[model samples]
Target: MTLETGAPENGPIMLDHDFFRDPHPVYREIKKNGNKPTEVILKTGMAYIPPGLKAWLVTSYEDIESVLRDPRFAKSIADAMPLFAANAPARQEGGGPGRSSLLYDNMANNDPPKHTRLRKPLNGIFTSRAVAPKRADIERAAAETLDAVAAAHRGRDGFDLVQDFAFPFSIAVICDTLGVPVQDRAAFNSWVQTITGAAGPEELARDAGRMAAYLRDLLRAKRTGTEDDVLSLLARSLDEDEAVAQAYALLAAGYETTANLIVTGFLTLEADPQQKRRLWSDPALVPGAVEEMLRHQSPFNLSLYRYVTETTVLNGVELPAGAIVFLAFAAANRDDRRFARPDEFAIEEPRREHLAFGGGIHNCIGKHLARLEAEVAFGMLIQRCPELSVLAPPAADAWKVSPTFRGLRNLRVGPVPGISETGRAHD
Candidate 1:
């Protein structure tokens, strides 16, 4: 895979079966050899992007951090895409365009000034400082979901934890956090699924439109005012479209990633029984265990392409403005240069910092909430079901279909669920 010019060569490779089965090997290949501008083909069905786009990937840990922190890397998806720009208007002082959900100016799709506007007011709500009150909600959600799993399994050997437990648990927490009314939850859940679920670009765009419209209406209602919920606070701070985007971010960030973390963390523990037993023996290690799980199975394989906004060079590699680049978080997380046995899972791994939450300014907003959710969710699972085990060996197709997202499509667990000594669940 070396270049003929005695330099490294990168792709125009298709994100095919081998990639879906395991992208890590390709990530390693990119890490070892790729240093110049290269193209990774993305099909339209892969995501909301109308596809056929080329993305240059940066895989080294240092370079990943560099690009994420560098202000020159554009976050506006509209800026990276001309198709989006025709529909999306200028980034207004209050918000960017809401022409399409795919092109909507959410926090993930904006550089600073716009990003700061969308993110600033929501920070206090999503902070560790705010996690304590929701701790009870998160814990109850976890315990209750596990309880349902136990009830459904009855005398059975397994249940789909991904659907029955992890998915709704995260969705419920987000709904409660956003103060979406109990009556509106069904509609809310539909929108979340449409955004996060596997669907073609046309379907995703339609769903995104439906989601955007619903949120716009919801945001309008919130503008009349309430003391609670992130949306109401955002409505007061931002304009109509900006408020809707911020509200959308809450659902977008809160759902899929958190769900994947719970599922992935559980699967990781199941795979390494020795490590699982160690965590059970010393439950104080759960926090660190959560971190290790996050690093070991970073929910995202590649970051959204960061368009080079200016000519940039770092560590002797140069990229011109308008160049599309992606930070391979999964690759960087497992870089041997930075981590001790990069591929192995160990709770006490000394270097725990990872690009899982991304880095620098464009980092995830719901991260603290996500971490707390994982802690409560996985902690409840291990403490209650000490005998928890995956029913069937993981097959290749068990992984999610999306090239960027990595999560188990189905994680069936148990040899019959057990009640905790504290009465968290009963048969």
Candidate 2:
């Protein structure tokens, strides 16, 4: 799926299934036709102006870094009124209220003062001082998940790494940390699906309304209850509306992205045997491995939409006010100028920054938690489930379509061979 552009003009390009499934080939083609900064418009009328969505797409690492850190490029989509108005019906109907509020005005969604205010309290929760105590508990949870998988499979046939391992593992850890009631797990899981899955506009609106009603009810109960949970913490800290908003934010932030990382990390490790072996041999490398995995397979292909606050020139391309931009973090991670052997997945590569969790003030607040979760979860899997292998082909080969995330819908795995009923493997 190569897209050939002539002379790098700014115009909309039809986004076919191939482009959505695998955008790299098209990105390379666009690069070939255009200069350093190019504007590749999507058929949906959304522009892919780089660095900031309002400007031209910054393909080079230096330019992307500069744009990401630059305050001139506004992160607020509300700034682009005309664009938002044009897309409002679609946007509103597609995951309004409970589902979209998390990304709409939470710390990650806002810029400057608003961002700072929202991020302050949440940031404290993820710092080393706060998170260090949870490490042992996290490790124990990971081990317990592996034990459950082993018991279920009994070293026979295969198991789904995504559903049976990563999904449940992440959910359980987050639930335990947040103190969500065990009885609500089923509803929470269903709500997450409605929020993240590709539902029709009407369906999305319906789901959002349903989720809001549910959360409101849950909040009311928590307000009168004796239990201490994340909801309770937020309730005590913020007003009712604000607390409910934070509840939505936590759900969106806590689940999908981590699930994508866990699934992609496993697939990447399975695909590259040498890297996997290195990870297995050196437990200390787990953190680096997780970072590299985050870089190599960025869960969010596109950053949140940002509108042009004013006319701006990025990398020699002029962008007008109200222009929509999508910072392609996935593309930036693979930029040759920033990363040596950018295509390769090497944990041993000297540490360098990547925009996997984004950059600037809008960088992920839960980064530490995500990293801790991945390190513990992946390390446990490799150590305990030594025979882990891909249940399905790579995502590119499978070509599953998702709007905001790229992940295998299903991942299967087999246990290490030669293990006895007592779980001892014959060498």
- What's the TM-score of every candidate structure? 0.87, 0.84
Q: Which residue pairs show backbone clashes in model 1? A: none
Return the lDDT, model 2, position 105. Answer: 45
Q: Write the per-residue lDDT of candidate 1 for residues 274-346, one digit (tens) a residue.
A: 9888887777788888888888888876776577768777555666667667777877888887887898988
Please report how far candidate 2 places residue 138 from its true position, in Å: 1.2
Query: What's the lDDT of the predicted structure labeled candidate 2?
Result: 0.65
Count clashes in each candidate, considering only residues at least 3 apart in sequence or on different chains: 0, 5
Structural RMSD, model 1: 5.0
Off by over 4 Å in 1: 1-11, 34-38, 44-47, 83-98, 225-227, 418-427
Worst 10 residues of 1 by lDDT: 87-96
